[model samples]
Target: MKYDPIDSQLFIKNRKNFAKYMQPSSLAIFNSNDIYPTGADSTLPFAQHRDIFYLSGVDQEESVLVIFPDCPKEKHREVLFLKETNEHIAVWEGEKLTKEKAFETSGIKTVYWLKDMEKVLFELMTQCDTVYLNTNEHYRASVETETREARFAKKLKDKYPAHSVAKSNPILQRLRSVKDPIELEIMQQACDITEKAFRRILQFTKPGVWEYNLEAEFMHEFLNNRSKGFAYTPIIASGNNANVLHYIENNQQCKAGDLILIDAGAEYANYSSDMSRTIPVSGKFTDRQKEVYNAVNRVKNEATKMLIPGAYWEQYHVEVGKLMTSELLGLGLLDKADVQNENPDWPAYKKYFMHGTSHHIGLDTHDYGLLHEPMQANQVFTVEPGIYIPDEGFGIRLEDDVVIQESGEPFNLMRNIPIETEEIEEIMN
Candidate 1:
């Protein structure tokens, strides 16, 4: 891992929290993500499953974690199964985690090789009446690929037909939503790295530069700061391209007086930080551009303040819609008639600002947080508001990652990143 070693206490605490939600005499299992194949003799990079990594801090493939708080045997309460490493395998694939290292990485003292998983699991199934299986239940998830966790879950159910099965997603959704102090610290590091990349692009962007050049600049800064590139597929949209919500072609040349909307972030230790900023290509925004940019910035600031505890996700977006409506009205994008005759399903402001104002940002860009539940302190979110004017040939978006506090306003993780029109202009010049 390029990132520094995280204290195992975070994983220990996470496991304790997760175990507390499990039924008595029940065991929960989590599996690492598959190292997917690209084709024959080639494979995509290995990315650890966020759930297992959250609880074990084991950033490797072919690993499994089992949590059984009420186990009769103390050591079996929390066990780790890792792929055993041999001298020949070490020489060919570099060193894998040793038993001692696994213990250090995760707080679990009992470690066994993957070869013994079936035998040990059989013993464990006999002791527990219920089993918890991890699943992808995030609101934005559209997974079609069969993950390692999914495969394990199928086999486990087939082998233990008598055991009552439960979903781990509900417990994890709530637990992972609220950030621990250690997790907040790591997320802050990710935001700081993203800030560096944004600042770099502020100086590197110029008229006639291709959109991909800025993308490369951001990647260079992320690598230098020990981050694993972007948290999500980056959007380096320039001019009318910015109107496309998920534009990532980054092939167009940035003309002078045009705006580039960059929605990118850095990932540190598998924690994600999401940020979005729209800047001018020529180091200065036109008068009309400044007007739209400031309006979006104002909406973002107000929307962030609404992320306090007790705010419901659906209601929060409704409120943000009102804020955006006012801003769009002021910007002359929506007139009185447009507001009054708008469809209730899609308001007049949707003509300009279409997407949701905020989403939970953490391990994944759209992290796990039950939308039906009220917001809580320490939950990090991204407040991104934008106005896309295709007729004007540009778009404006301003976003920041914020932590909902116990009291007062939410804390901005991207506070160091330049957002104000004057500051961005000054930096670019």
Candidate 2:
């Protein structure tokens, strides 16, 4: 892990909150994600399951956590199972977490080698009448591959058929959605790293530069700042590619008059910061480009203010759609008749701004949050609004992460990052 060790208190407090919500005499288990395969021997980098990391801060593969607050033995109440490390194993695959180190990282005293999982689980199952299991229940999740946690769930259910099963997603969705102070700090670190990368690209992005070069600049700054890299796939779309939404080809050379839409963020300590900014490849926006850029910026600013505690996701889009519609009208991209004749199901504004205005941003780039529920304080979200016009040869988007406050306005985490056209121009000059 390139990131520094996090304060385990966050994990400790998270476990306490989750434990409080568990059913009486119930045990909850979380397993680490599998190191997926690319081909023979080669594998994709392992990403720790967010739920387990949220509770224990264990960022490694082949790990398990069990939380049973109702257990008779105090030590056995919270336990960690890690892959065993020895001299031979250390030489080949590097040192896995030792029992002592796992205790320090997770704040859970009872730790065991993976080989002893069955014996310890058998003991824990005897004391608990119910078991809490995790699943990919995020609103946007479309997990086709069976995860390690999914396999374990199947195994546990078949082995202990009599135990009552419960879904852990409900408790986690609410708990993880609201950012604690400690978590906010980690996310701030990620945002700071992303700022460095963005500032670097401001001067480096010029005519004839490949989009991949811009991606490289971000990665360099991220690694220098102790980040593993992008929180998600980095999008460095140039010109008409920007209108395609989710364009990650990044192979085209930026033209002098073209605009580049960069949707990227750095991952620090497994917490994420998502940001999107569209800038001119020539270090200056044309008259028409600047017009659309500021329009998108205005929409992004107005959309963020609506992230109050009671705001509903579905209704929030309705409000944002109105704002975007006005902007599109002002740009002459949509006529008044377009609005009047638009289908209620697909608003006229969506022709330019199709996606949602904001989404919860945290441990995952698109973090887990129920869209049906009202918003709450301390919940972090990204307010991104874009206007894509392929005919105009430019698309503009502006985004920032902010925290919903209890009384007043939401606090912008990217306030220090250069955003204003004047500020960005000055930095590039």
Candidate 3:
């Protein structure tokens, strides 16, 4: 991998915590994501499954992890099955992980070749009464294609019909949602890289520049800082395109006096840092543009303070809605009449700020956490608030990743990334 090696103690603790949640005699399984195909004889970039990567630090394809904590033999308690490397394969695809390297990458001492999976699993089945199968139960998932993990689950179930099967998603959903100290440090590193990229763009962006050129600039800085490009597909929306929440065309030219909304973050060591900043195309915001930008910035700051422990996701958004309502009132976007007669389902503030203000941020841009449960400390989230008016010909959004605090307000991870109107203006100048 291009990224530096993460401490294996994190994976060791993760596996231990997951095993604690498992039922006695249950063997948990996790599989790496397949290298997805794009076209004939070509494939898109290989990305590791977040679940498998969390359990074992093995960031390669065609790998598997099994944790039989209650196994009869001690060595079989935690095992890693990797794609074995040979002379010809090494010459063609470079050297894969050696057994000694695997031990270092993951804390598991017992390792085997992928060819021995069936034989070893057959033995494990006889020794265990229950099995924990991994599944994609993420709230935002809409998986249609059968993944390698799903297929392996089917084979395991068919082979051992007598064993009681359980789902590993519930345990992992909670575990991965809460950030470990090490994970948060890595995320902070990613955010620092993203900050550098944004600062670089602040000096580079000007009128008549193509959106893709900005994208290129961000990627150049991200790679230079040991990141694997963006955490997600970047949205470099300019002009009316900013009204589209998921706009990623990046084909338009940044016109003078227009605003460009860049929703981007760098992925460092599989940890993601999400950030969104809307800046003036001509290195200066017009009076009216600054008014709208200031409104969004105010709302973002207020919303981030609400991401404290014990705040529920749904209720937190309601509080943010009230905050946005007050900002819109100050900006003259909503009048007294609009506030009094607004529907509770769709508040008057939503007329200007439509999408959600915040979401969990970590491994994925929209990371995993139990939304129904109350927010907790160490949980990271993106506080992004925007106001889009296509007729107005521009939009403004200010975002920062924050960590919920145990005592007081949440801490901004992107605190160094310039957000204040004056700061941004000064940087552009």
Leading candidate by lDDT? 1
**lDDT (C-alpha) at residue 303 in model 3:** 84
* TM-scores vs. true structure, each candidate: 0.99, 0.98, 0.98
Residue 74 shift from truth in candidate 1, angstroms: 0.6
Candidate 3 lDDT by residue in tens digits, 15-105: 9999999998889889999999988988988899998899999999899999999999999999999999999989998889988999999
For model 1 the TM-score comes to 0.99
Q: Over the stretch 1-429, how does candidate 2's per-residue lDDT look in tens digits?
A: 778888889999999999989999999999999999999999998889999999999998999999999899999989999988899988998878888888788899999999999999998998999999998888888888999999999999999999999999999999999999999999999999999999999989889999999999999999999999999998899999999889988999999888899999999999898989988888888889888888999988889899999989899999999999999999999999999999999999999988888999999988978889999999999999999998887777889999999978899999888888777777766
The residue-by-residue lDDT of candidate 1 on 230-343, one tens digit each, is 888899999999999999888999999889999999999999999899999999989999999898888888888889999999999999999999988898888999999999
Off by over 4 Å in 3: none
